[model samples]
Target: MNAPKLRWVLFTAAVTFLIAVLLTSFFKEIRKVDTLAATLDKRMEELVGEERKTQKLKQDISYYSTPEGISRLATEQFNLVRSGDRIYKIEVTSQDNLQ
Candidate 1:
């Protein structure tokens, strides 16, 4: 064919090849972006769950730090009696005596 025509054909083919390469790279970058976004969403969900647990634990700590709660815990858990309340002790002289 003519030189001018051949040059035009080569230029068109080169442009088409470049376009294809650019499209392929663009698609690969899009997939990477999608993967990154999904990962960020998953991490955000985990952070939200962790934040909720932290808030719940803080609330529990605040609840237990109250005077009434402390007193109740001391009374029931430690068997602490109020002031002037009497407690009796019973002792068995021998383990087999009652039997």
Candidate 2:
């Protein structure tokens, strides 16, 4: 019961199905790209955090390697007195120091 003019209808249906399949494949690729982008962003943030920690450690190392830092630590932390320097000790209780 098919007519000779039904070829056009079949061609249109085929084209529509191909376009639908192509659109679905394109969306899947987009989803994969989005997931990769999110993972990369997380990794970049982790790297930044590690870099910040590394920089802090480097600053700390630099500070400790200097003479002034060492001198300050020795003078403030330890009761060591150098030559030509006067040392004095004073103790104050919390209750008696109140103004």
Best by TM-score: 1
lDDT, candidate 1, 1-99, per-residue tens = 646788899999999999999999999999999999999999999999999999999987897799977877888799998899788889769868868
Best by lDDT: 1
Poorest 10 consecutive residues by lDDT, candidate 2: 90-99
* True lDDT of residue 68, candidate 1: 77
Off by over 4 Å in 2: 1-4, 71-99
Candidate 1 lDDT score at position 95: 69
Q: What is the lDDT of residue 62 in candidate 1?
A: 90
lDDT of each: 0.92, 0.90
What TM-scores do the predictions have?
0.68, 0.63
TM-score of 2: 0.63
Tell me how candidate 2 scores on lDDT.
Answer: 0.90
